[model samples]
Target: MKLLILDLDETLIHATDCYLDRDPDFEVGPYAVYKRPGLDLFLSKVRSQFHLAVWTSSTRLYAAPVVENIFPHDVDLKFVWSRERCTMRFDPEHHDYEWAKNLDKLKRRGYKLEHVLMLDDTPAKLARHYGNLVRVKPFLGNLADRELFQLSDYLPTLAETPNVRRIEKRFWRKASTSEP
Candidate 1:
């Protein structure tokens, strides 16, 4: 199976330590995270198709509960990674984050360079690995969101593709083409 590395916080779930509501789907210390709609079904379909792993930018302490709540016990996820496993670079322009997910780290772990795909919302996170990154629109507490299924619809064909490197980024997101 091809490798599919996922990102949290606005990708799989919406989380914020800055806000609090009466009730939340998940409570991770001071952070409140909500499940993205269709996440379960999306994971179900993808689990069968890819060697699934979560590589969120969030720290282990914060991302742990969120992962458990969203993925639960039945999800056959292969691995869960956090900021510790990622590489950090200082961006003078953006002071918010100290690091970005380094896809090369996984490449070194024997995941084929041409056979891996990273589903992330922020472009900067995948800046060094642009070609292999599929830009999924960030999800933020949208229970009606269908982004997961939209991706699921495209994955079967993606899994069947013999050369992942040849697959253009257009097929990765919202662009469409009409050609015979």
Candidate 2:
């Protein structure tokens, strides 16, 4: 199955410069609002063809509000996941090793690596893990950025190409062989 995995912070929601009033009593991930142009159209198109899921580093308590604001009520909430599934690191200098946790989740769910498409701004997270991810730079602009535009450009091509199916099969084949 085709799965679309998205990052929440910079990918879906653009953070404002102001600091959110943190509830000292309640410590959680930072609160941020989203900004994007034609986001509704983009989301609608995505919902049409793909099984949508969120693979964000944000904690569930923090990510839930933002997701509800962005997605329609009818969208399945079961697909939303949080940092609990992410990889964590203690080294201060090392970047958070959290993004690829969703990849594991997807694999456990029987999704082939190629059939899974991750849209993330940070290449560092995906560079070492999955090859099928479409890396996009973070943008706070009013319109869809170049990476998203490129994805749009490729959708039609992907739809018409039989090679994509072959690629998915190959990925599954490799996965089965690797399994004990």
Candidate 3:
């Protein structure tokens, strides 16, 4: 199966120290975490078509419990990598530092780049591997958000593509809606 790596934070759930207007789905330390709408259904549907994993810029301490609460126990993650796995790079455009997930690490683990896809809200985090990315708008505790629902419908379409990197994904939302 093709590997589908997901991001945490704004990509799947919105975690903040301050409370939002509504109660959070779960609490992790000082953070109140809100699961993105349709997260459960998204994971369930995508699990069958891809080898799922998580790659987050947050510490393992923060990412673990959030992942536990949001993900179903039946869906086994191939790997759950934390910030320690990311490389610190100085972003020339943004004129600051950022933690970038280098997909080469997966390549070292014997996974081919062509068969891997990463879903993240921050394109900067995956700057070195944009071709493998399917960027989503950042989720920020919006109860009515439906990005995951649209994503679940879009992702399965790539399950059979031999080289996912060859596909242009910047306009994924439009592509998803236009599909027959």
Candidate 1 local accuracy as lDDT? 0.76
Off by over 4 Å in 1: 18-22, 92-98, 171-180
TM-score of each: 0.85, 0.69, 0.97
Relative to the true structure, how large is the alpha-carbon lDDT of every model? 0.76, 0.58, 0.93
Off by over 4 Å in 3: 178-180
Candidate 3, 1-180: lDDT as tens digits: 999999999999999999999899999999998999999889989999999999999999999998899889878899999999999998888999999999999989999999999999999889789999999999998887889998988888899999999998998898675333
Residue pairs with clashing backbones, model 3: none
Of the candidates numbered 2 and 3, which has the greater TM-score value?
A: 3
Question: Per-residue alpha-carbon lDDT of model 2 for 1-180, expressed as tens digits?
Answer: 366787876676566544344312122245345445455666777776666788787678877777777888887644888887776543333644444453655678777765666777765555445465555557664343533434444443343333343444212322232222
- What local lDDT does model 3 show for residue 149? 90
Best by lDDT: 3
Provide the RMSD of all predictions against the true structure, rounded to 1 decimal: 3.3, 9.5, 1.5
- Sort order, lDDT high to low: 3, 1, 2
Candidate 3 TM-score to native:
0.97
